[model samples]
Target: MKPRSVRTSVTLAGGVAAVAVALAGCGDTKAGDTTSGSSKVTASPEAPGETGGSGNPTGKATPDTVPGHGKTGQTGGTAARCTAGELRAGWQRQPWSKDGHVFATLILTNRSGRPCTLAAGWATFGKGSSGRYQELRTTRAAMPGAGTTITLKPGTSAFEGVKYDATQGCPTIGGFGVKVHAGWNDVPGGSGPVVLCPDSFTAGTIQPTMNGVNFHS
Candidate 1:
């Protein structure tokens, strides 16, 4: 009788151990789920077409966020990308632009009544002219200070050099469009997109200064 009692007690203890192991397994699974949920908090947004701020398409890596001061290896304060709603555009022809090539500086102003950053690798478009609002096909040119973090304070401006062919039978327009890491906005002010011809145009890099370019990415 005593031996039988001891066997029963041992059996009960084994069952309790098995139950503990099962509970631990369930706990591990729950912990894994919690970790995954935490990661989602910091994940990047998945956007399509065009780019986010800092010139990379949304849903992908963009410099600074180009809000994160991204992997461009360029370091700066983590500033949010400037939005189209906050920006206004305009242009001025460069003094040295010749007869064949129309060289001009594309100016982007921060009209948001606040400060923002325009990441590198911005895109520019020509406004359609002659009772039209067409986006012209403009090319990009390689130049000094083309790709750099441009900090635009309230009422401040960023500049880009544009070179297009005037002799190529390009059409006239009332304004130009500027696209940075964000969407396109009409830069309509003064003479409007004079350097912008609908057919052939080339845009240079953006810089904080109108005269000199920065060579860093």
Candidate 2:
């Protein structure tokens, strides 16, 4: 097994970014996010100062069969299926984030000895507490080519670009979580709390994290 390398990243204002992990041999080894759906799910408006586990309309609850969980379109790869244990998760703030909209990338690395595949769909996730994405996050995909299975070789990585916003005078998030397989893993997002009122939040499709790829906003 390769040694787990420590990665570091630029901190967002207010220490929203916690103690970070760096990419080992990859460029900078920052955080990442994931997206899904054949088409994008528009976010619904929530009341101001509203806070609860009540996810967005397009968002699903945990233990998701949402899109890529068990669907043939999302997981038809011949490579060994990736389990939650074999992958490590992290998140990164997008360089283009601005104007109340916070974009991020979700990253999952294969730490096992063998190569495997990831479900080519929206990641099931939520913001609140560590490893407790009780609510599933929403995702939109680039269709006609979205469900192409992603193979993760040992030490390689996959990513999802997630979209969210921070409302002024709202609550703060404890952290974030996402599901690869088996169960939910933490994907720390500093996108603040409260999915209310004009706050849009949804992930983009899963893709191979290379050449500094990003899920477009």
Candidate 3:
């Protein structure tokens, strides 16, 4: 892996080049809310005043449901079988720092007797009035195509991680929830899986530490 920098680029670890993963294996997001159709979900604002998880020690609020955990697409339910065997795909979000930095990893395992391709990207959102999104950030990978492609042996899994700087506006960190969408095409299987993880942006320290809540009128 390359050193973490602001420059937008995808550097493959095992000398792999320009292979975009076909992320269609996982389900897509719903039109309006990311949590639509999800089981009893909730959305909370940036720490402090909200009636949810108490604010981090610094007094910042902890966001409710993570951003990407919301619903995606109208067709709800477990994926249908389009292929012979079962293919597993999922991603996890790990908090790097409370100061708006995060890392994400994608995992794909092929149960069939062959290899597969995968693609993935992140969708960011913020809470607004009437339980809607107020802000969104869409990032295009610095690579040549949509995502990286990897071949997996039967019963074997592959892992990939991407580091990002989540400023106040970019909703990856300190914002809402995040989810991973992964899949393989030209192979037998159903739609991929979506794993949602909640994130806390306002959990960071105040300007000089102990920065109180920002109450607006």
Candidate 4:
């Protein structure tokens, strides 16, 4: 009987050991599965063409579309037109005379401190005497080409031509002057007395470049 009991105890102890080993194996398998799930949750997504991150597929930046933003051409800002009050006038008479006509160069100088634009157009010729202004009529002549929009910096100048015809018995006029009309401003200009032939006066458009008084004809 003692021997039978000893065999039974050995068998029972062996069975208990086997069960413990099986439990340990199961616990290790469960721990491994938990570690693998944690790694998947913390992992970052892979980028395009990269090992782990996402970015622009083509890798090119966007371009600008705003006008005058990055290209040359007309800028959005325009120069301000010159005012008559900001101009100073002067004249240079040519030495030569032809066909009973005297020629003189008209100069319109900017007196303001800012830059301004001068449009191509006609100017007024007149005399200021006895506290009254008398405007002279400009003889009809062929228009001198198209006038250009000229930009003048501060202290800059523009030029024009004036023709006085003495062939038609011009009245003896003295104290001649020229007036520059820029936009809404009409500024008078002259130096000393301007001896002009009456009823035969003509003026030319303001030119961008200096061509003397003969450029009009």
Candidate 5:
């Protein structure tokens, strides 16, 4: 009976050892699977040109490159050309005389309540008397460079220079005036009983700057 008991005990111990070995193998396989999953997660990379989850470029928005875009006030956008009815005409004779010639500035003021644009273009001179108008021969000189469109706010003014040889004794004419053609508007600009040399009557192109006018020569 004692020998039988000893054999039984040995069999039981062997069975327990086999069970422990099986558990150890299972633990090692689970650990290896966990490690492989962690490596795959860490190694993944984002694709090129990806802007996070938003999908938009990561920078400031660009401004409009079109002409007259996002402007404000009188210069905000395309304005209507000034007309004779909306403008008040005036003149200022310059103090200094040069080379027997008289210089004067033809002034055009905006009388309308809104803003308007004026093109720098040809100006015509004429005599306004006896309820009749006669166009004077005007010599047009090219501007130093290209002239830009001028915008005038309400109650503002633009100017053009007038020059004539006073020494020639051509005529001391009353009701001398100028008609400036800008865009589709032909507006009268000037107040005169000005003495004009009709033969040498010359007008400069309308400009926003003095450089465009032949003030000196």
Candidate 6:
């Protein structure tokens, strides 16, 4: 499991609220769009597009490559071929649904240094009803690389979301979220995924309800 970055995890619950506030801001509605501490925040709908960070997308490995620290190695079946870049970080979600399925959204960010790319792939694991742990699902997107140029400036990021729908013959999203130990095939080796929660999970905070507790399968 990635340690979690504040930028990504903290914003999970705000998704629906963001849209609500943005809608209420049309006329004389009070200033509800700004999230508590984020006084300058404005709400807007998220769009589907290629997401990532900036930097030397084609450079040496970064210092933050610790296990469960977000940047996974390319050995465990999943690979995101990041050439050489400055910084590569991602935001992910683990919120459960009404029907018992957990949804995940990975928002990749680049801090601009070199050009790089992330492959689309995923895996899931957790305990099963039989009291034994099992691999729920593993997937590889056909697209080779989601490339980004090194020219992007610092603080820029990208977003991508995929649902592990319950398919009889495929991996289900019911188990406790899997440890993101795999990387894109392009960067094969095996490392941990960078987590998206920042600060510690707290009551009423987005992290707690979104990722703090794990559901037993």
lDDT leader = 2
- Put down candidate 3 lDDT per residue, 132-213, tens digits, no spaces: 2233222222111122223344565444333234345432212222112222212111111111123321111111111122
TM-scores for candidates 1 onward, in order: 0.50, 0.57, 0.29, 0.51, 0.52, 0.26
CA lDDT of every candidate:
0.36, 0.42, 0.26, 0.36, 0.37, 0.23
What does the lDDT read for residue 146 in candidate 4? Answer: 31
Model 2, 1-217: lDDT tens digits are 2312222221222224321222221121112322222333543222112101112212221121111111111234468667666666645555445554555555667767887776444454444544443343343433212434677777776655555665454445544444443454333333333332232555444556422334334
4 against 6, candidate with superior lDDT? 4
In model 1, where do residues sit more than 4 Å from their true spots? 1-75, 129-135, 168-175, 179-199, 213-217
Candidate 1 weakest ten by summed lDDT:
3-12
72-112 per-residue lDDT for model 4 (tens digits): 11111247765655555544444444455555445556668
Model 1 gets an lDDT of 0.36
lDDT of 6 by residue, 1-217 (tens): 2221111111122111000000010121122122223233222222233322211111111222111223222211222323223333333333222232323333333345543333322212222221222332222221122211212223433332332333223322211222222321111122222121221111111110112112211
Positional deviation of residue 70's Cα in model 3 after best superposition, in angstroms: 27
Q: List the residue pairs that clash in candidate 5.
A: none
lDDT of 5: 0.37
Candidates arranged by TM-score, highest first: 2, 5, 4, 1, 3, 6
TM-score: model 4 vs. ground truth: 0.51
Per-residue lDDT tens digits for candidate 1, residues 1-217, read: 1100000000001011000000011112211121212221111111111222211111122222100111112223356656666665543433334455544444556667666666554343435332233334444443542355656666776655544565435554454333433243432222233333434544455556555421111
- Quality of model 6 by C-alpha lDDT: 0.23
Clashes of each: 9, 21, 33, 3, 0, 51
After best superposition, candidate 6 residue 211: deviation in angstroms?
23
In angstroms, the error of model 2 at 135 is 1.4
Q: State which candidate, 2 or 3, has the greater TM-score.
A: 2
| TM-score, model 5 to reference | 0.52
lDDT of 1 at 35: 21
lDDT rank, highest first? 2, 5, 1, 4, 3, 6
